[model samples]
Target: MSPTVHEIRNAIRAATGRFEREFEASFTKEELQAICEALKITVDGAGRPSTTRMRQQIRAQVGIAESLETADDSTFRKAELQAIADGIEASSDQ
Candidate 1:
């Protein structure tokens, strides 16, 4: 089975030094908000803070480069490929 989100979060946390505070990939909305407040990052004009925008801003402030993982789309099953395509199209429509 694929790893759970909590498992992924735990694995990332384990990779960091014992006392080091590297930003995590699986922060909840509340946890992310706390991080932003601690970092003194003000939100852009908005009703609610976007977790995605907050993550980008935090990564930028902390000098962490966001890396994109590339993979062969040909390796994915048709249903999986369709889901990915659907997600891309939906996001593009926004």
Candidate 2:
């Protein structure tokens, strides 16, 4: 049988309590509450009901996002891209 909504809610609350307890040990309770509130607000902002699809998208994006930081360690590629654009503009102007 599928879990009832109350069961899911209770499970979520229990998990949140455990998380808060761990965070509170390192940070103030107020900080932990604020962080949780911010996360809830972000999730609730989406008008559509969030489903497993949303979770999968977040996981996929996180995998790529984490790699972007050090994807190219050789040099500053943003600067290189800008220089290439500038060279093209200069060539077009001549």
Candidate 3:
């Protein structure tokens, strides 16, 4: 039987939550930008791109990065974590 719309939405939400936690923990700004480019996602705007924009673009391109194993932390860095946190905080302030 086909899944209900509610079931599909719930499944997507759960997957997105998992992706967000893993992506934030492992990806850097540069890495995200690269992924966006690879996915042909535009990360720029009339002015400089906002982190929120970049993040949305990256999230949309999560499938590209999803192949990587979450158990691998080799690409994770402290600076990237700080950047993600700062961007989130800055957006919240506005």
**Most TM-score-accurate candidate:** 1
Off by over 4 Å in 2: 18-94
- Residue-by-residue lDDT tens digits, candidate 2, 1-94: 5443333323333434433132212223333233233234233344543343333222223332243333332321333322322322311121
Give one clash count per candidate, in the order shown: 0, 0, 0
Q: Candidates ranked by lDDT, best first?
A: 1, 3, 2
TM-score of each: 0.41, 0.23, 0.32
Q: Which candidate's lDDT is highest?
A: 1
After superposing candidate 3, which stretches have Cα over 4 Å from the reference? Answer: 1-25, 46-48, 61-94
What TM value does model 3 have? 0.32
TM-score, model 2 to reference: 0.23
Pairs of colliding residues, candidate 3: none
Residue 41 displacement in candidate 2 (angstroms)? 7.5
lDDT of 2 at 26: 28
Would you list the C-alpha lDDT of every candidate in the order shown?
0.43, 0.31, 0.40
TM-score of 1: 0.41
Each prediction's RMSD over C-alphas, in Å, is 14.4, 21.4, 14.6
Q: Model 3 lDDT vs. the true structure?
A: 0.40
Pitting candidate 1 against candidate 2, the one with the higher lDDT is 1
